[model samples]
Target: MELTKEQLAFFDTFGFIKLSGLLKADITWITEEFEAVFPMLEEKHDGSKRTMIVPFADQREKLCSLVDDPRIAGIAKSLLGDDFNYMGSDGNYYTGDTGWHRDGENRARRHVKIALYLDALDGSSGALRVIPGSHRLDDKFGVDVKRVSQSQTALHVAGPDVPAVALDVVPGDVLVFDHNLFHASFGGSTHRRMFTLNLCERFGEDALDELRAYILLHAHFKREHYYGSAMLRSAGPERRVHLEQVDALCGDYAERTKDLPELPLKALI
Candidate 1:
């Protein structure tokens, strides 16, 4: 289940990699859990803007265990090391196009997203698109992309016209991409189902302040803990290694949010 050295190299160079049908056998259960989560929150996707539940997998035991799955853990360990931090999950019923953007503009930490798309898709049908090597900060190409893509005057084209790789996928496919990578999706149905597990390299004591800041940026989802109680209680030691770091640091979310503006209940796409 582990990625080969060459596969790792490909990711490091390209900013993403796709594993087709990697979770095919588990697709049935995964799909069921994916469907059950939204109902637990008493919210239904009405094919509107978007329906998102942060700490999505935390609502159900089966979904919580997704991060602990051997095949999934192997991918995280391969890229971010064994002591990676589990940065929570997001379940979505995606609507319309997602304009080009990176997750966190900070390029300091090694943050990666593992996306599980639950339907068939192609270049024109809401498939994920990524600009190759766009994650590199020092390269001229990356610099040009940052400059040109940011304004219509520079590129004179819309996001959908941007040059990129379209990653076509099916029910059981997994897509892992760098957080800095520029990505977007287009021409999709209103009720496209997908979920993501975010993981990143654990920070050292010297960099903990930076990590804390990153956690605060996303603290809108949690009340007191970064993860839900069900997610933590169901974890074994192996899974705890991934969840522990964020759990230890995110306890101050409520205190932090006291002075901040009110956050929307559901995350919009």
Candidate 2:
């Protein structure tokens, strides 16, 4: 299940790669789990706006084991190194258009997201679009793309009109991209089903403080722990490697966020 050298090169050069039907065989159960998770949440999606849950896969044992799946693990190992950390997961039911934006501007360590879209989509139907090579912030091209993307009105064009590659996908396809890559979606339905696994290169001791700060961002989701009980309970040695670093820091995370006031889901959105 390892990525071919050509595939690796494509991802490194363009900032994203789509592995079509990679999860086809497992999509049935995968979709079942996805549908099942929403009901377990305290808040329900009334279709007015986006609804999201953090630590999504951790809610179901089978989904938690997705990290250990060879297809997924191999991709992470290939892109971020064998010791990459599993940062977190999020499940979503999206509403309309999403403006072009990067998930992060990480200069210290490379981070990648593996996305699973549970329904069919194309450029005209809310498929993911990315500006090629925009992930490399250090590059001049990336810098200019970021500038133009942030100010589309200057060119008299709107978001969907921006020049980019549309990555059309179906139930079993997997889309992987750099965290710093600028991406957006357009013409989507109200209930677009999707989830993502976020992973990053293992941080060194020098970057522990930065890592902790990043963890605190989870407070936006009102998350006390980065992972759920099922994920922790189901992790074997192989899976534990990805979880250990963040697990060791949870004590500090809890203490720091203990006083943060809880807000309603819609308010957070």
Best candidate, TM-score-wise? 2
On residues 27-79, what C-alpha lDDT tens digit does candidate 1 reach at each position? Answer: 99999989987775544677888888877888799888888888999999999
RMSD of each: 2.0, 1.7
Please, what is the TM-score per model? 0.93, 0.95
Model 2, residue 192: distance off in Å is: 0.4
Weakest 10 consecutive residues of candidate 1 by summed lDDT: 260-269
Stretches of model 2 off by over 4 angstroms after superposition: 259-268
lDDT of 2 by residue, 47-70 (tens): 778888777898899999899999
Clash pairs, candidate 2, are none
- The residue pairs in collision within model 1 are none
